[model samples]
Target: MSDNSRLLRRLFDERVRDLGLTAAQARLLLSLDHFPDQNQCFHADRLEIEPITLTRIADRMEEAGWLERRSDPADRRARILHLTGKSRDIVDKLQSTVEHLFEDTLRGLSATERDTLGKLLDRIGENLARAREQEPVHG
Candidate 1:
């Protein structure tokens, strides 16, 4: 699974390089598009990355006019992340690229195989989440 993830990430990076984005940057944009108006901390957790790391990627993105971090109305200290018009325009292209990548990757798999694979992956995710919840706090 790790090998497959690395290969898919490499392919995605190659595809997005033409759009002037790194894999991390592209992922941030895609995540925001799908789950819009979330704060930076939410995005960090969703991406399974450190908050500082997300902030760095977001800083670059913000400078590139891809997104904005506006102060949350409900919480003066929290900054809500939002995709800019420029990023929104590119999201459709990015999403299509992802769809094409998945289509190519699953080309030889039969419908049943694909369904089984999906279910198995979902189970793995659930198991991992359950294990995480059961673990003792490090502190």
Candidate 2:
């Protein structure tokens, strides 16, 4: 699964190369699209990356006019990420690129196979989530 993920990511990177985004950046942008107005800490957790790392990536995206960080109303210390007009404009293109990539990747699979794969992946995700929830708390 890890090998397949890496290969898919590589293919996605190649497809989006002309759009001037790395797979990480594209992932960040897409994640924000799905779950908006989240703080850096939240995004870092969702992306499974260090807060400092997300900060650095956000810094670049901010400079590029793709997104902005605003002080959260509930917590001034926390900065919520928001997509900019520039990013919103290109989001469709990004999504379409992803769809195309998936189409290519799953080209050989039958519809039933695709449905089964999706369900299995969802089950795995749910199992992982349950495992995380059951982990012992540490100080």
Index of the highest-TM-score prediction: 1
| Model 1 quality (TM-score) | 0.91
Q: Per-model C-alpha lDDT, please?
A: 0.91, 0.91
Residues 4-44 of candidate 1 have per-residue lDDT tens digits of 99999899999998877888888899999988878998899
Q: lDDT score, residue 21, model 2?
A: 89
Worst 10 residues of 1 by lDDT: 17-26
Q: Write the per-residue lDDT of candidate 2 for residues 3-115, one digit (tens) a residue.
A: 99999978888878778888778889998999998899998999899999999999999999999999999999999999998998677789999999989989999999999
Give Cα distance to truth, residue 105, candidate 2, Å: 1.4
TM-score of 2: 0.89
- Model 2 CA lDDT for position 95: 95
Residue pair clashes in candidate 2: none
Give each model's clash number: 0, 0
